[model samples]
Target: PWSSRYGRRNRYGPSPTVKVATPRDIRAFFMESESMPRSDYLSFPNRDTIDDTIADMQALAEQVLLKVDKTIEDQIPPPTAVLEDELPLHYDGLELTNGVTTVFMFSFPDMDIILPQVDIYGWTPDVMSSGVFDISSGNAVAWEDENLRVGLWLHSGWNQTAKMLQQYLELNDARYRREVWTMDEFLETNVIGSKVFIQQYDSFRNAKIVAAVRVPPEGVYAVASHVMDLATYLEETYPGHGFEKIIDRSDVLMIYFCGRQLTGEKAHPDLPTAQQSRFIIALVPEGS
Candidate 1:
């Protein structure tokens, strides 16, 4: 089981309920909390690069939003510069490709464990895969080999994490048409072939979008290993409740996301550590 300070709860007594704030809420907090150090690392594009894409899809009555990965700080050095098509890597080596997927967002302040929340809209397949549909012509097309994507939310006490986890499971079940597991299932099946766990530049900023449209079997195995590790950690840290009934229902397969492993500590001095954090739950396609 993975051990960390995050696992050990209040040693003195039962902790208070932590109010998990939304990204919009966090953005608001950042605006108000002058004392809180500004996250200089949070970068926004100057122009709306996807305006045309948005306009083209507007006829479909869809709202356009930006997908951001909080782990960018761990990937690139100071003055992070990534091309629009670039995909950043997650700590688990899943490449942050361009597609719709669910994400978990959380905040931790002064031991206030702001548990993760499901953000289905933050990055959904239909929304993330821009240019795939032509609203004007009312036609849908498959995405090219090269594409990239990004995106998450919050909840309470120890039950907070559980609740959020449940929400994520439910949302994923409804949205995605595939088998998803929480990690335990991978171990049970022994399908996790390759494991890559090292503290390095495993952030979104460092990842490049997958040049290929379809991920091969090797790619699937690499991601499954990380998913398995996360599941084991979650199971050990928060045992019982059958891990929101997701892990118990797993087939041990995995879906790959933004991660391309890099080596060594490429820490940025200006960026404040722990600005925001996220946990990912993915859908594993079988026959990997």
Candidate 2:
């Protein structure tokens, strides 16, 4: 969409810097599970299609396993047992209540600790970053673009991480309840009012907060520059973890893992200044 309005004058300069994830890359994820010691076959579902299972033993003799993240490996939950006899016919052999999938998590400074699989009550938005994974297909469950395939999902997922940011709002409103907003109208209302709207999304603080907005090609820079500034602020506020804007699509969806209710504390001290008002207001649930 940005390309259409601006005639695609290399909006962000060269091609998108964010590398899209591919199906092959997703398939390789299985290798990590394969190397893990399994107590039973069900622990690692879909075993028959593993590369090692179909590869010649001689050819694999000299190969070594890729290193897995020790933190994730150590924290992987054990399989839960299900009593099939006690279940109804439709539910037979289906571990509906107990299924496991790997998700990415991030730790940030001045942020509460997040435990993805362990926090069953959803009291805290413990998982800072993660994507829905399709266990049966061994692929990421996300939006797909013709050119990027699964990469669109990965890029969009990353782009959406702004939802987790701790925002400092000088003003608030009740009207930002929609899932999508036009960039021009959003800026006209919230930015001009110096307001950030996100109060009605979910009563629970830990619920996932997602918002999207569409910007015309001509006005793309108006929003993008502020977003990049926020990205920079995020990097400065939280060390080690930083935001990357690799996608320049007109419709942008942002996701935030709500930690406690929205707080008055500024994510960074410099936010909401006269020039940064748009940046601060844009971080609300109304998108863009």
Candidate 3:
């Protein structure tokens, strides 16, 4: 042995303290080897080599989040369907004809026509003079709440008539009410955007015809006057047929009288029995 004392111990406790590597330092040293090829870097072969790998991953996640937020903000969900399997169709436009205006028509192909159920009548002094029963103002005098009964009447008969006509056309049966003249429900439902006419039979006579036509966006005039003209035409053309009273008959004659001023017009020399007529007729034949 050379000098064992010199090699083993010196003046201090030991020659010098040899530094032992810490776990953190060893891990760091191994992590640096990730960039090399798999064969060259055995310690951390699959690990990322970047110093701030965690920060970079967080930044990329934030970018993805921003893109998702933008997509959600820009897009709107589509509206849900209300009437499933129903196709949108526009109704036919009606034309003013024969002095009478057609207001609406409700019919289906190979099916019976749906008659109107409502009508509205307007009241004025001129109409009162026309000898038509003025149901305008009633005696609400006792109940002092400014009781006003405007010239309005509910015609159930008219509604019944429409229903009866519909039934007749659909069932091919004539067993229906013959006295159904007016319909109040139909008047209330269909009387939209209508005009009130205070028609005078004669200026001096003070007689008036208070009526209104239910002017809908579609169809024929729902007025007694127009109905009467149609009925007359049907009776003339079809002759001795009860079809002149139904509302569903196509090819039924329709007469429209327009621009006939209500003042001082010689009592329509042609309509001699106008006074006796209580109801206007709208005729509909069985097969037509």
Candidate 4:
């Protein structure tokens, strides 16, 4: 059971009725009404002069609209420079004890936007007590990998962010889609086998992927391990749920779990400690 600061309430005992306008009265009122102009119309000097003035005003309006568009575009930091300088990294010797390397990639569109930071919590009880692996560790690369994996699993919804951003930019500039790509599709197609790519949607038509390596859970070996198990369980127990199998071996496995744990020996539900979790693992074809 989950609890929140705000909860819904329902009142059952309510009885009140009031009569207002009848259908006959409403129909008679509308039948006697007449259509009228909202305001008095002003007459222009001459047809020729009115046409000339209208054309001039139209040109001025177009210029003003263009200037506003340029001003908004200027505020968004350009992605061309950031993408050129920061490329994805690949590692070889740094392997986790579980034999699987977790890779994470984060994308940022502009310098003004703040990217999400990562925090790693181990399965051990002593891990949190020492405060060693919390969010504020100087090891950004390590934390980034962990948090990126967690983000991929926890924030797994249909690519609404990409779609909303696309619609917004296209409203002002018709050429937006040619440069902008969906973040979900970009990660799914590009970094499938090598790393986990996670990113945020921004106002501009640009994106970035920050990459790092992570360690998998105790028994999990490859990215496909947990996914395969979950798929099998769903198929066997709840076949009616229509959970599909992983068609492409290149697809990554992202998982998120939320639960509560008992503190010490007390098992009170109201006082239990809450836990939130996320993990991402990449899977490649057997030969690849």
Model 1 clash count equals: 26
Residue-wise C-alpha lDDT for candidate 2, range 8-107, written one tens digit per residue: 1112344522223343333333223223232211111122212334344432332211212235533353222222222211111211122322232222
Error of 1 at 115 (Å): 22
**Reference-based TM-score, model 2:** 0.18
Q: Which candidate is the best by TM-score?
A: 4
Could you give candidate 1's per-residue lDDT for residues 211-279 as a string of tens digits?
A: 111122223322223322434433454454133333443322122221111112232333232121122
lDDT of 4 by residue, 208-262 (tens): 2222121112212222233323333333533322223332221223323211211
TM-score of each: 0.19, 0.18, 0.15, 0.22
Error of 2 at 19 (Å): 29
Candidate 3 off by > 4 Å: 1-100, 108-110, 114-121, 131-288
Residue 208, model 1, lDDT? 13
lDDT of 3 by residue, 34-80 (tens): 12232221111112121336665665455445433534323322111
Model 1 off-target regions past 4 Å? 1-40, 43-228, 240-274, 285-288
Task: Go through the candidates in order and give each one's C-alpha lDDT.
Answer: 0.25, 0.23, 0.23, 0.24
Sort every candidate by lDDT, greatest first: 1, 4, 2, 3
